[model samples]
Target: MATFVIVGAGLAGAKAAQTLREEGFDGEVVLIGAEEERPYERPPLSKGYLQGRSEREKIFVHPPYWYADQEIDLRLGVTVTGIALDAHEVALDDGSRMSYDKLLITTGASPRTLPGQAYTLRTVADSEALKAGFAAGGRVVIIGAGWIGLESAAAAREAGCEVTVVEPAPTPLHRVLGPELGEVFAHVHRRHGVDLRLGVSAEEVEADGVRLGTGERLPADLVVAGVGAAPNVNLAREAGLEVGDGILTDAALRTSHPDVYAAGDVAESYHPLYGRRLRVEHWANALNGGPAAARSMLGQEVVYDRVPYFYTDQFDLGMEFSGDTRGYDQVVIRGEELEFIAYWLREGRVIAGMNVNVWDVVDDIQRLIRSGGPLPPQD
Candidate 1:
């Protein structure tokens, strides 16, 4: 039997193992993880789970016994020290070696750290630590207006804590959503008793609060820095694999080495839809990319093409989006700003669409984007 070794047992790695079994590979599968816990989905880590509205069991991608039942060797709390392609083996931290006919890397990404009294959320342990701070209704001063920061702000407020979000940008999500739509989020957070401070950053994270760049100090019992994440590409880079921003892979998810494959947040896969390469770090990408990488590993002719999809829920807003926002010439807004759909158009063709507080339109929006034709003018 062909032995397949999978590094990093996140959602992508777990799903890939499941796919291998379902596809009747009948191979000896090994799943390894640095984290001691079972593979779990991360979206809830910053949302439901952190908000005390979700249980730990609900976060797991698969129950504990599922791996044993599937006849897969699941190794938890282990680290891969080195990958030896010439020998078709991996050196482990435990001084053991694992050989594989095929190897998959789903190492994922790590949260960017700040040099201060600040916390970042990445693993369940991180969430648990933050949850303890929220239990006391502590004052939270979050640095960064990105998705993680905004979501953490909303969750902290939900926990009866005083929340203040400080961003260097003019508005929340300004870089991704642009200033106009970013203001919408700014208004929502401010309306919900959140002190949304724009165009400022913490000069230093003090013991009791944050000192702003403009010489203002905000009291904070808990400090969170959700600046961003960096792809865990050191392993691939060390192995002499092509890496740029992330581990470089083709549309089918194959890496520079034929026997080596990558998926999820760490894999910079070529997107046929955009005719370029992008490394997407979202729940949808991990959930879908896992199986795609598996199919390609099985020597099946495949092109991993799927419309990028992501959603977020904060306060009373629930939004979903499809397509890429690159090279868009115009943004068309339909309905009111708060409860509306925004379409990014390039040369009269829809390139991306986002809906906020709107339901049952993602399918149609995706169709229009894929159609790459003119959309009806907003009434």
Candidate 2:
């Protein structure tokens, strides 16, 4: 039987393994992960799990016995220290080597840490620590105004902590949502009693809290860092594979190296729609990209052209967005009773859509993007 080696046991690695089996590869599949725990869903870590609405067991992507039943050799807590591309083997931290005919690098990303006693939410342990800190919080300082930072702030506020968000940008999500929608987010957060500080950089983080560059010190019992994430591309780079913002891959998700592939947050693959390279970190990308990469590895010529989609649940609001908003010419808003959807049009085509408290229109908007049509006007 052929041997396949997969590094990382996150969503991408797990899904790729399952896909290989489903495709009847019948190969010696070995999955190595640095984390001791089994693969679990991460989206809930910031929302449901943080709020105590979901149990630990419920967050798992698969049951413990599922790997054994699938005949997968899951080596948890085993980190791949090095890769020998010429030898087609991976060096483990335990001084063991695993050989493979094909390799999949799905190491994913690590949270960017800030100075001082602050925590970044990327793993189950991170969430656990944050939850414990939140339970005993007086004032919480969040360093960033991105999606994760905002979500953490909302959760902290709901836990009865005085939350303060500090961002160097002019407004929250200014780079992603632009200044317009970012203002709406700032308003929402402020309305919920959050101290939304924009255009201010955190000069330093101390035992007491965060100090702004403007000589303002925000007191805090706990500090949460949601700055950003850096892709884990060290292994791929060491293996002589091309690495840019992430592991550079073709449209088929194949790396520059032969018979090696990458996917999920770690892979920067060519996007058919945008005609450029993109590294997406959303749940939809992880779930869909895995199968697409697997099929490509199995010699099926396929291009992953799905619209990037993600949803954020902030308090009572359900915010869903699809497609890229990079070059949109205009935004069209459709407002109803308690439901609103915004469509981003670029050159008469719907490039992206954002829905706030409107769940029903999300699918239709995505379909409209897939089908291609003249976008509706903004009210």
The predictions' CA RMSDs to the true structure, in order, are 1.3, 1.6
Candidate 1 TM-score, C-alpha based: 0.97
> What CA RMSD would candidate 1 show?
1.3
Question: For candidate 1, what is the lDDT?
Answer: 0.91
The prediction achieving the highest TM-score against the true structure is: 1
lDDT of 1 by residue, 115-214 (tens): 8789999999998888888888978999999999999999999889999999999999887777767888999999999998899977999898999999
Best candidate (score: lDDT): 1
**Candidate 2 least-lDDT 10 residues:** 370-379
Tens digit of per-residue lDDT, candidate 2, span 121-222? 999999998888888879999999998999898889988889999999989988787776777788888989999889999999999989999998998889
Query: What does candidate 2 score on TM?
Result: 0.96
Off by over 4 Å in 2: 336-338, 371-379
